[model samples]
Target: MPKMIFVNLPITDLDRSISFYEAVGGRREPKFSNDRAAMIVLSDTISVMLLTHDFYSTFTRKPIADAHRTSQVLLALSADSVADVDATIDKASSAGGKVDPGPKQEMGDLMYGRSFEDPDGHHWEIMWMDPQAAEQGASAFEQA
Candidate 1:
């Protein structure tokens, strides 16, 4: 079986978070979801577990940091093309997520990326890269 990644996040509103994730190419997996938590399946191997603050705290002794005020991690996903990257970001924004919480990223055709903040301010980055450049290394694209 292929390995999978489940990212657990602390959110305030389960319903809203579920909707936001859905807008960004995710669908709620009811078998693993409940009132306090929702399992958003972003891809075959990528899932985001949205847990309320109270529920999330149960998994860790450390205090829950407010994502809106602090940064803990940046979650990134790859896209097939630059248009796809932008489309994801656009959908996120339409779903009420903040667009471009940080500056947009462009690496002269080598890579293209953009960021957005979920309702709870969790950061997400959508990116696309030149396939050949990625396999060949950035130096391969360097000018003479």
Candidate 2:
């Protein structure tokens, strides 16, 4: 079997978080979900595990940091195009998330990325890379 990634998030509200993820294009997997936990499938190999604070504590003994005020990690998703990146940010905003919570990243003719904060304050970024340019690596573009 191929490798897969499950991003487990500590959330305050399970239902609301599920809705937010759905609005941002994730499909909920009922087989792995219950009242206290949910699995949101983002892609073929990527899924998000939304766990209530109580449930999440069982997995880690450390205190759960408030994502709103901390910056331990920044999650990013790939987009098919620059327009898709912008559309994702818009979807996040429509779902009550904070758009552009982090710095905007722009790479001339190479890449484009936008940021958003989920309702629980989890920072996320949607990015797109020029396929042709990416195939040649950033160094090749730098020399142009």
Candidate 3:
């Protein structure tokens, strides 16, 4: 079995968060979801656990940080192409999510990426890479 990545996030409203994820091309995996939490399957390997405030609090003693005010983590995903990355971010924006003012650019032979923040203030980055360039060990920062 392959190792799966689980990203847990605290949400004010589970239903609303689920809707937001759906609008961004994520699907709910009911088998792994329940009233206290919902599993949003972003991809086969990447899944986000959206937990209610109470449920989320159970996992840690520390207070939940308000994403709107401060960033706790930045989530990034890979894309097949730059167009796909742009479209995905556009969909996020149209679905009530906000795009960050500008994206950081890292030029390379075969790597491209962009980043944005969701309505709930979760940061996300989308990237595309060329397999050939990867094989050649090209680094985006180096090319830039």
Give the worst 10-residue stretch by lDDT in candidate 1: 135-144
Candidate 1: regions farther than 4 A off: 138-144
Top candidate (lDDT): 2
Clashes by residue pair, model 3: none
* Tens digits of lDDT, candidate 2, 1-144: 789999999999999999999999999999999998999999999999999999999999999989988976899999999999999999999999999987788887688999999988999999998988788986856876
In candidate 1, what are the lDDT values of residues 38-110, reduced to their tens digit? 9999889999999999999999999988889999999999999999999999999899999999888888878
Q: Each candidate's lDDT (Cα)? A: 0.92, 0.93, 0.83
Model 3 regions lying over 4 Å from their true place: 106-109, 138-144
Q: What local lDDT score does residue 41 receive in model 1, on the 0 to 100 scale?
A: 95
Q: Superposing all C-alpha atoms, what RMSD in Å does each candidate have to the true structure?
A: 1.5, 1.2, 2.0
Q: What TM-score, to 2 decimals, does candidate 3 have? A: 0.88
Q: Give model 2's TM-score versus the native structure.
A: 0.95
lDDT (tens digit, per residue) of candidate 3 on 1-144: 799999999888888888889988999999988889999999888999999889999999999989888978888898888888888888888877877534654565467788777666788888887877766674534664
